[model samples]
Target: MREFDSYPTPEARERELADLVAKASATIPGTELIEYGRSVEHRPLHVVRVPSPAAGAVPRVLVCANTHGPEFIGNRVCVGMLAKLIEDPPPPLRRLHERAELWLAPCLNPDGYARTHALDGVGSLARLRHNHRGVDLNRNWPLPAGARRLPLPGAGSSTPGDATYRGPAPLSEPETAALDQLLTSQKFHASANLHSFMGTLFPPRVRTRADSLAYARLCEALRQAQPHTRYLRIASRVFDTFTGEQEDHQHHTHGCWSVCVECFSFRASLAQSFARRVPLFWRFNPRDPRPWVDNDVPAVAAFLLAALDLPPPVSPRASRTDP
Candidate 1:
């Protein structure tokens, strides 16, 4: 696994996470591995559900990755954290997983990932930000309350073409449908969606004004846990909040502390973006000089652990409602 971690291609990211699920399930007795649904290209939508199943009392948490397809760092970090949790989880994580449930979806857009992997025409593949139908899985989600369309940029945004389309309607895509239903079925204590290329931690639906008190509280918990993170946009609505980003839908609809974290700088930062662009699976040199930080993985892992330890912003309500 460590060998694969050094350099993982986008296509290989799903393959590796699937492998971890299989291994982890076999090792844990009550663990439930479910295929929520299939992607547009028939890529299995897999999630490792670690639940007590005793019912009543335990809350739920969903930790996901690969929702953006090209953002590959979360895939590695999710699996790495899972491994660590199994072997030596901190008190918060151990207890959280033991009492509450952990729903880990390491890859959401397998097709987009596959396309991104062979972008050089090395495999005659062009990356897309959409599912098979060319829809953005994130934007197609249905918000719980009556919310308007996501605030988007221009008609043609520089956003990657791979999978950011909002589709014709909310819950129009299977990926969003599966997640929306699953998340709604039960209230999650907190949910986090992982991404990459931004060396920062942020909340969903950044508002234009001061950090919404709700988001600010969650951000504080994360920042205090790990002081190294580039805590930006503490109180800024996303410039483009049009298409019902998954984070917004999840937080507003379920009233869960829905957070979306960007992990590395392969694309977002010119300073070291070139380094991450190199296929993680491709052989590279430790001695090779690159603008990068070694803390990406640990930083995220610690933040997650801290989240588990912190008290909920409010005593557990039956559920939260926003749209």
Candidate 2:
């Protein structure tokens, strides 16, 4: 068993992911790993597919992490979950694999992750959040061309170096485009884009009553898996929302049920009296990866399981009877 307590740099992270895929393929009956695309600095984006047993067109669920460079906790959670499933899948989990397909993209922003690692260490919170080109990958989705402006106060930024800088145009960044391609190419029943430092599980916008109920059950399943976690229905209200985001694009454009998960929280600044000097990175990511992985990965796994069992969301008109 690999000790996931410490964080890995970009190269190390890629190697770890490769190792995970290799081991999984050797151990699990049907595990496939593919190089989906490349980052700005040419880092290969890898996706691991775990097929179902009853396999004629099973519902696909995407579990992606590390869209934001500094928020690495989700990546750890995802990797841990994959490891668990590969190593010793519980009977229920085995049943899940027998019914639904699982896809995982562990690190989406390799350039930024590597850049941040080059600039700062574990104790230093001065990490880089944007890619090598300084664009925020989360904000670079292919939203309508006009919606690509400086986002509202809490939404996103227009400034290149700023943390929330939405690029000059939608799908402008390669990383976002690569992910966009994946979402658009295949039909994913649901997706969980993992993020961090907030400790909350958010469901995408729920417009209809059926959508609301389905999400409620899904959130409950996640909560049941990790009782300490909080479930927020509309993430927009919490973060004030932004365009070109993965969850929003997945749900709206691709018709996939998607949510951005804030994996774990840690604020070193609030913990000590000498907090004035520590950088923001120290505050954004957890120091040790074990607790966060142990608590949140199961919740993610449970959510995927719940999604498989959930009835498809019905439109308002479809749910209403003509009088």
Candidate 3:
């Protein structure tokens, strides 16, 4: 319904995604729509479920996007994959849907997402990174070892105004708490939190050899998803120890094999004509997310699908027993 290869505004995207999920639930055999919780601004947090009809215990894999609002490309990626599953799933993807329970939450931060669209001129770029309360949701999770507070020196900022502010406490914001509650309630074998404008794929900081091997296989699978698009692993020296990050928190608390996927660009670069035409905030996402959706949805979906075959995370007691 939208213009060919054009992106939707936040409001339009939300309605379309909800409609797509509703259609999938009505038409697709095993699809269902799930409302997990509400965002701080009271927007519904949605998860589109692609459940397996087969009898035995099927592993669950979650694909979530828009954790950081301005990075909206992943939202379309989720929609495209969900549509593919409903319409004409490829052989491998069909197999994935058959073998695993797939859950997709396309837009996790609606307030920030809307803020990106609501602002005029440079305001969008300036306010795109934080929620309405000015907290960076991605940087607001509890640290490893069940620590609630991130050390002030390395926690980005104690004040709420900064882009990377870790918030007054871990999971202080409603968006992060809703996500955390989802993890606590359901056991996901693996999860991928999608972001954009950094063109990197960062696997969680894994502890065991089994987890490492599983993570490596996932990395390779994602790389193979896009023929020319290179997916880089986040380096250990810097990104491995970011306090209160979602990937770190997911793995630390639930033993879920999680990854942070940054797509679209390695760095922010703009086409000469397009940059002059649109606001700076639009540049954070791909100029046209539709093309990226066609190229990367399968790859993103494949990463979640591939988790079904990977080694499950080590049990907490076993992990504790190891060195």
Candidate 4:
């Protein structure tokens, strides 16, 4: 797990991700690894599927991480579970994965990861929350297209340097399109896109209203499973002011269960580490945040187990269309 913090070069990370996938495919007879699409660098976006070939299974669980470059510890956690499920398949993981499908998008923005890593020496702060185009992958998702996508540039401006810039249009990037294809191709029971920094759990349907209660419930349960994470629904926090979000697109359009988890912090100081451990404590201010040595892996694993046991929620009522 310390490999998660070793800060590999962008190429090394991609190679490691591919190696993990290949190893899993070889180790688990039922698992298959497919390349969804390529990043701007022509690096393959690996989507490892467990028992996707298995027929007659109910809805499956799809967990992905690293849509952004630097917030990748979650990606590491996802990859670890994936490799474990396939490579040294415990009877539980083997049987569960046989009945479930996991789609791990390890390094979704390879171009950004590589470029940023190069910019500041292997895997630096530049990799956080943005892709090669300087756009935030999480913030760039197409909302219910139409005027609802207010403020044109939404939470942030379209300036390339902005952290949350929405691209020219929805699905303008290969990453988004590849993700769309993955969602359309399968019937998923539940899905969560992991993140780090704030340690907050987010849901696609974020409002506190009745229409979104169930979604909130799911998010809360997941967060509760990981005590380190505090539940912070987007609608309540961002006021839908944050437009073009992946979670909303997945929830409103695809009826897919999705979430955005702020996985860890960027601060590296001891004070920062202490604050994260006890956010309520005073006099503990951090500068740059580094990932917690031990992440929420165990809790996240348990949550996945519970989520898979539940049925898929009703998809949004809108006519299905790739966003």
Candidate 5:
């Protein structure tokens, strides 16, 4: 068995991620690193693009992780997926690469990620979830036209210090604005926002029956493609409230088949709960990340491939019904 330490420190993580991108680009044909935007702290935000082997305009897929600071396992899984794609892609990933252009953003919230590692498990978990200016990047996305924020639990908060604060306005933060620009320009056919510890796949809140069914089928593909343990597919129901989440924004505004992939497992969380003093970070990420990485990488590939197989959305600016 391989012995592993806790998650990497901020500086080490940045250096390692850059090195991984550089290596991938150097070894793999058509793989390039793009610096799309910078975070509030001036940390460069990058996406590693792996162009499809096929000719002409093909579908595009985006896999981004670590929007929240403490969920470091998502970053690991994204890196592992990229490595698998370049080194030895399985059937689904190979098919995906052959059919579509893939972009991997390993760490979306670098500022928040750095802050969490800097704390060294010393601060509140809520504080670790926000960016440098204390804004929740995941909840900072623009809502669909005419869709209002319903009064519901876990939707988001207006309070500055709260965990799910949605910032002053949509696209207010540099990180989210950068991602929005990327999504606008790329218009990906499918996207997966990697999160941790929930052990479920959450599809965006759909307004139409057709859209809901499409998401259900896409999530089922993700569930069936897992070689190891499978996660629950949590499809959004009609009455579900709209949170200013990235998946929702991607699906509604960009017409992308998007899902919030809650990696890790409730079983892992249960095990961590037995510890006398488990830090918030350990609760979200396992000690050895290999198992989860091995499990999720292929599932994500299958999900993206399945999305490409589905029919395209009605329109890029299609309006979704308000709750």
Candidate 6:
């Protein structure tokens, strides 16, 4: 019975998140708490808006985490970043605050998070990847035009019980639908969906050379801005297969610069592999999440600032075939 004392219980985390949002709303002049939608288990999906005081139209950035149940480190990063913004933002974060409106969706799959925590550090891997209705929210987005299902493994699955199960149809799950709605309404200039244990920044599927170059530049900015260990930039080449991921939908349909930040590290996974009886949750999340949070929170700010510096898109809504 390994005690995960370092990580907060699901109930405690929820309370802390609510408290943080309340504090920000009360203390920060332009902060707001928006309840976008409800989950399968009737849990409220919320986003905290920290609006910029910059005049005229400003860039907006969406930072979301915890799409996968067991990868709670991403959630920790979001909360920690929010705390920093509320208390004392560092140089990059302060610059981001001055230039962009930031929205934080700390836990996109709250039901799945609670379910994973209920396992108490012991469960099958399948239970740690899906929502209460067993759908992988990350894989439930709309696929881009000309993007076909590849024969490659880990692309995503159509099966219900599998880890990457994409659900019966695109945007079928309530969690994904709620996120899609937010993206549609907000029309963010840039976004980062946080995941864990890959230590890589994956851009959305690229269809053209120009798109690929743009993502490469954006990811390079993220890498250069990290105060600690930098994540590898796994930019999409021309032939990368579309996985109906949120980042792809954001980039293709909304013309937003979106990337999936896979936090923690593969090296950490290798180190944990030697431990006996390590639970599936522990494999995805570290026992102590502070270091990863410290490393990633600033990178999130850099991601937004880089996008804000880019030339404004000709149109906010892009066709599937548009680059």
Ranking by lDDT: 5, 6, 3, 2, 4, 1
What is each predicted model's overall lDDT from 0 to 1?
0.57, 0.69, 0.72, 0.58, 0.84, 0.82
lDDT of 6 by residue, 148-215 (tens): 76756667788889888888888888998888888888889999999998899999877768777878
Rank by TM-score, highest first. 5, 6, 3, 2, 4, 1
User: What C-alpha lDDT, on a 0 to 100 scale, does residue 320 get in candidate 4?
Assistant: 24
lDDT of 6 at 245: 88
Question: Model 2: clashing residue pairs?
Answer: 125-281, 125-282
Kindly report which residue stretches of model 1 are placed more than 4 angstroms away from their true locations once superposed.
1-15, 22-27, 52-56, 90-92, 120-126, 150-163, 206-211, 227-229, 237-242, 265-268, 274-323
lDDT (C-alpha) at residue 181 in model 3 = 87
lDDT, candidate 5, 191-261, per-residue tens: 99999988999998888888888888888888888888799987757677777899988887888889999
Tens-digit lDDT string for candidate 3 (242-310): 456777767767877788888676443355225376665556666667667666777776777777776
What is candidate 6's CA lDDT for residue 308?
87
Candidate 3 global CA lDDT score: 0.72
* Lowest-sum lDDT 10-residue window in model 2: 314-323
Runs in model 2 deviating more than 4 A are: 1-5, 90-92, 121-127, 144-151, 227-242, 266-276, 311-323
Candidate 6 residue spans exceeding 4 A from truth: 312-323
Per-residue lDDT, model 2, residue 82, is 82
Residue 140 CA displacement from its true place in model 5, Å: 0.9
Instruction: Name the top lDDT candidate.
Output: 5
Whole-structure CA lDDT of model 1? 0.57
lDDT for each residue of candidate 2 in 86-111, tens digit (9 for 90 to 100): 87764445666777888999989887
Q: What TM value does model 5 have?
A: 0.94
Alpha-carbon deviation at 43 in model 2, angstroms:
1.0
- For every model shown, the clashing-pair count is 23, 2, 0, 14, 0, 0
Query: Residue 52 error for model 5, in Å?
Result: 1.3
